[model samples]
Target chain A: MIPDDRKYTQEHEWVQVEGDAGVVGVTDHAASELGDIVYVDLPDVGAEFSAGDSVGSIESVKAVADLYIPVSGEIIEINEALDGDPALVNNSPMDDGWMFKVRLADPGELETLLDAAGYEDLLGK
Target chain B: MSDLKQTPLHQWHIDHGARMVEFAGFAMPVQYEGVLAEHATVRDAVGLFDITHMGEVFVEGPGAGAWLSGLITNSIIKGEPGKVTYTAMCNEQGGTLDDMLIYRLTEERWLVVMNASNHDKIVDWMQRHLPAEGVTMDDASDRTGLIAVQGPDSQDLVGRLEALAPHVAPIAELGFYTHIAVDGPGGEWIVSRTGYTGEHGYEIYLPAGAMLAAWEELLARGEDLGVRPIGLAARDTLRFEACYCLYGHELSEDWTPLEAGIGWAVKLKKKAGFIGRDALAAQKEAGIPRTLIGLEVEGGPIAREGCPVLAGDREVGHVTSGTFAPTLQKKLALALVEKDFAEADLMVEVRGKRLATRHRALPFLAARVKGDPRAERALS
Candidate 1:
């Protein structure tokens, strides 16, 4: 299910705004499409990236996909738990699977992202 | 999707919620549950696979054995009836055309099973080389269906078939690489004690029309036995772990059987000289230039197929197949590299970054295909 609290990208990533920071992770549809993620290459905390820059990668049993940053920000935290158990992405894509927390460069960028209804339309759900 | 071919069990796969993908021109199931879970099911318990896309060719007549012996790298004439010999067919240059299994039903009858992608090519090659007399070849691919039941509990799941018990040996008594043919109401069924997976398994070849019933029956009977439906994704991982050479990946026209690490299947001294015997002999005398070796990459990034293998900035070779081995819990890759750098310090270039890798043995995991039944029980 597409969560209403988070804004999503066409690349299948979602970001939930919390104060000045945004928690990012792939959507459930992306996790299911990936098919049993075995490894997640998380970006380093404090790493800076521009919008649409590849932050890291998600490696599944069959293939791999790059995780793109939706907006310019500096990484403040990464989920270290994924290093030991990446299947969490498939098990809890909307909650415990949060990949990284970024200090948002422009909160206004959140408005440009697709809301639940918009994302559902994009996915033709 | 309309252009792709479908197996007789295609609807069953769809009804069971399998994710389908295009493979070898056929619309096949890539996974049912998930690759990791399906892979684990095969390694730990049992799994069924609909491999109906694979090709089956029948050769009959008095000269069948001799004709086949001259075509394959391995000696088919030397193998007794009921035995399945794995061999490679090659061109005059010793480049592999396809790797397949030849089942000798009798002195004058043989059955060849080959890769689905190479079906047309292999059949064309065989037809061109058909002898003027004493041998007849028939391609039965479209009319045949294949089902593979693999894993530790495979024997128990397959042995429970009362229909098979009346026709063939008790599944437990069937020797490795052996098969028994039965004339059933549907058609002739050939149950072979052979499989691509390293686990104990069996491959049943029957009429295409009868596949759906068998598949449904197996699932119905295997529900309590922890048997799950496997797919192409897990099939690759399973065969990769077993160090089996996938045609396009490991065995190809670009790499000979010797360099591909299937030299055991290539018998240069067989009584009948094959198409590429001279070339393979010459290559062996000159020393193999490159060798297929297993590698374990450090870190999360996988060195996938086509990734360059470098030895201190010099390109050595490329990865043929790589994945996060579900059973070993490590990132592993099979690379075709210069024989000199096979054991040397190497790095695989993945996504513009070089990752350190260590040379590992051919199979990342020990194959338990033929061993004490107790050993399988111990693992389970």
Candidate 2:
């Protein structure tokens, strides 16, 4: 399920816009598919990335999945708590498990993301 | 491009919402509720596994013991009736063909439980070595189904099987690696006190047609005790934590028994002259070049199969199986490294980054065997 307040990416990342910044995290559907998340690889703060750029990765007991930057932005903060407790990604993926936040480089890039309805349709297949 | 083979319990797995994947040519369930939950259930409580995809080959008739002893790396002649010996069938080059359980039912009859992926190869290999007019080999894989009830409470679970009431007490008291023939409603069943997971468990061999009923009975009787149907994914993790050698992973055609650290199973002085006796004996005398070692990663990244093992900058070996062990709560791995680096703390290249890891002893977790009360006490 996708939250109405956040825009979704085809790769299953969710971004909630708050002024010039957007909070990023994987959707519940993605977390469930990945099983128990054991490790989360995050980039250093202040790192810059373009839209759809390879950011980090998430490792579960089953396999590893590459995390992608949704909209072009500069990294502002990361969930440091995940370093010791990665299971949070499975327990509270939408809230506390949020990977990082970024300052949006282009506000217009937000238009390219999928809405709740579009993500629901995408998951239906 | 043919359809994947389905176990007799396929429909049941589907009804339980099991995620199915192709393994050893069968559409096997990889997980049901989840990997972590299923793994922990078996470690702490009890769980059932549908291992029907594993192959069962029967070797019977005159000279069966002699014939089997010549083929496998273990001393088969020493095992009495109802004895089960874990051994590997190797080629003349000392390469492991497959690791299996040899159940000696009688002097003239034996049962070999083999890996599903190597069923055809092992059958063909045995048939090629047929003893002129006495021995007969039968591949009963398609007609046999195996169910394992494993954990600390496994004995209690087996006693709860209504059909096995008359035969339950002996089975519960049976020594480790021993089995008994019990009569089920459908026919005679072979219950063995052997398991891949390092838990006290039993492997029941029943007719394929009778497996569904036996499974249902076990599940129903053990319901209050939190018995759940475990999948292949949890099976891998459980056995991995116990440091059991998985067919394609730890034991393979490229490695020998001595190299895998299971040399205790190989009887070098056995007079039966096993297929790879000379090569294994020579390898033992000269010392194996590469040995399998257990590793514990310091950080979070899970080192998986094929990851490189490094002694400083030099590549020493590659990992066979690795995962975040649910029981130990650490990233553990089994690697086959050069004997020189087998004892040294090494580094592993996981996802292109070097992570500090140390070579620990085999069996990252302790097994709670029922027959051995001392082991049970030690485990506690």
Candidate 1: which stretches are off by over 4 Å?
A: B168-170, B373-380
> Which ranges of candidate 2 are over 4 A from the true structure?
B370-380
* TM-score between candidate 1 chain A and the true chain A: 0.97
Error (Å) of candidate 1 at residue B63 is 1.1
> Could you tell me which residue pairs clash in candidate 2?
none
**What are the TM-scores, per candidate, against the unseen true structure?**
0.97, 0.97
What is the lDDT, from 0 to 100, of the residue A121 in candidate 2? 94
lDDT of each: 0.90, 0.89
lDDT of 2 by residue, B64-148 (tens): 8888899998887877898999999999989999999999987898999999999989999999999898888888899888999
The TM-score of candidate 2 is 0.97
DockQ of 1: 0.87
Clashing residue pairs in candidate 1 (N, C-alpha, C atoms within 3 angstroms): none
Error of 2 at B357 (Å): 1.1
The residue-by-residue lDDT of candidate 1 on B1-380, one tens digit each, is 78999999988899999999999999999999888889989988889999999999999999888888899998778778888999999999999999999999988999999999999999999999999999999999999999999988888788666557575455567788888888754889999888887888899999998888888888888889889999999999999888899999998997799999989988899876899999999999999999999999977699999999999989999999999888888899999999999899999999998999988887776667775532632211
